[model samples]
Target: MSMSFGKSLAGSVLALAAASAAQADVPQVATDIAPVHGLVARVMDGLGEPALVVQPGASPHSYSMRPSEARALEQSDAVFWIGAELEPWLEESIDTLASDALVVELLGVDGITTLEFREGATFEAHDHEHGDEPHADHDHDHASEEHAAHDHADETAHDDHDHADEASHEGEKHDGHDHGDEEHDHEGEDHAGHDHAGHSHEGVDPHAWLDPENAKTWLDVIAEDLAELDPENAETYRANATAGREEIDAAMADVETMLSTADDVSFVVFHDAYHYFENRFGISAAGAISLSDATDPSPARVEEVRDTIRDLGVACVFAEPQFNQDLVATVSDGTDVQAAVIDPLGFELEMGPDFYPELIRSIGDSIASCTSSS
Candidate 1:
């Protein structure tokens, strides 16, 4: 089996190339939510894409794993999740999959001042309005005070905003600031605080990524986790995230610009997913919706929002691409708020691989176009 010198070197190079390709095969990281996929996509931006085991349209809160997805989970290098409380269904199998598979429940890692659900708080935020109460049109510097308090509270935590996003930025937790600290007279500006305990806010404003700032928080953790899981590719992951995060930064800039000039920058959303975006950009909005991801407004609830829209002079009524637009129309029938669609799910947008960033941009564009035009 003697070979020429050049032949032997060529053969060795070929073998090494093949081995590298096989080794670099992207990890089959299964996510508990679509937003996690966004994280994964950003992490894998320079690297290859991971297999998206769980998909859109499927409810992560109550999703049933298929045998194939189960197999993928078992084979995955890591399963990045917000936490079991956020996605209860995946808790059972998280440990059963594989011993080597790293299950990262990031909710624990994020440092937030969480406000536990009052009582009987289910996944339905629609069971109640965002936070303690829907805002009335009042010009209060509530947000500034809320941030001061949150920073004051986070006075000690390592991960300040990260914990807050893990808590989903429920309006109530921020609104739940102590009465003595309630200096802001603004109607809807009281949202602050993070639930570091991870007890539960039920499902109050679970679309943390909707806010560009929170998306950056999650990406920081995602980049760190990816580095830990694959130290060899640490540079690649960091570089990718740093570059990809610019998109989010740009999106934040865009949202800031859009909301700054919106004359009647307000809407009644089918869902309360936009609170983070609205609050972040200072866009005043009213909703005939609740905090839960899949809650429908009741007749009485619709009327309440309708009245608010009329009173607040809300410009647009928003709906999700997946939900019933008819409901939004029916509720906002005679009000000045025109029914428009906004997607927190990232379902309809062309996000390339990084769906979350694209989703944020899309949301910003929609908000800007709708509000400014209104």
Candidate 2:
């Protein structure tokens, strides 16, 4: 009996040693968004899966970190996020919780092309044949108060003459003094918050993954970072990243072919999150209902978007799965425009190696569906 017990203990010790050795090379990684996790998962296909911070069906723009998510960040070996511009809320939380982890800001990665949120960027008006006539000229500069007033007058000449001015004052007041305690707390909350000077909302467009070229760039970065962390799996990571790049390139071609079949299509999304996708595929949207999801668009802003749909002869208005569709329906109610759903976040899609391509391709399909029929 004593000999048998000694042999069993030796066997258990050997198994534990083997398990620890196997896991020694693996790093516990985490990502900020589902689409980003999809990319990282593809890169670490054979290696391991990374934790996702922003779960499916949640908007990264307005996500509040759950305690579980916070604990996950605390325990992660590496945390990858786009940047402070894409997720200002995560900036402070990450800094506070994961100060020791290898934090990567993908938007700041070299070779990734970042576009600015134009003061007044709109989709180019194209006919069914894809012939691009000059769309509305963006000559009205919003930065200059005089030009703003003049353009507001010119655009709203029909309705109550003082409506625009009154609304402008109301908006200014809301921004300055009437934002309420919740909004004020969000703005002033301190947990190693972001330096908003350069990365303000008006500066960078954070939808880089929508472009396949940028995905390829980010994949290379991911592989490189993982390689630095786990040299044993360096070759495997590089191979997976290369394969992922090829897959993304193929998906980009597929999107181009799919989107080309449709013409005379213009859309307005829930928010301005699809510009990277739009600019990549030459597919244009008329405008967005709001700038960000954190705050609701004012009534005047919604009315302005309604006017855009009418003036641009927009064919379809697309809302996001993560937001209320009633707003889209309201915008299209009396018009000939069709209301549809386009999800940029892959909120409803199964997330994995194929998620990035599916997200991009689905947007194309959604646009084609509405535009081709219209």
lDDT of candidate 2 over 266-341, digit per residue (tens):
6778777876777677766777775532234545557767988888888888887666567788778789998778
- Report the lDDT tens digits of candidate 1 across residue range 238-269: 77777777878876776677566773565766
TM-score of 1: 0.69
Query: All candidates' TM-scores?
Result: 0.69, 0.75
| Candidate 1, residue 186: how far the Cα is off, in Å | 34
lDDT of 2: 0.67
lDDT of each: 0.55, 0.67
Which residue pairs clash in candidate 2?
none
Cα RMSD (Å) per model? 12.4, 12.8
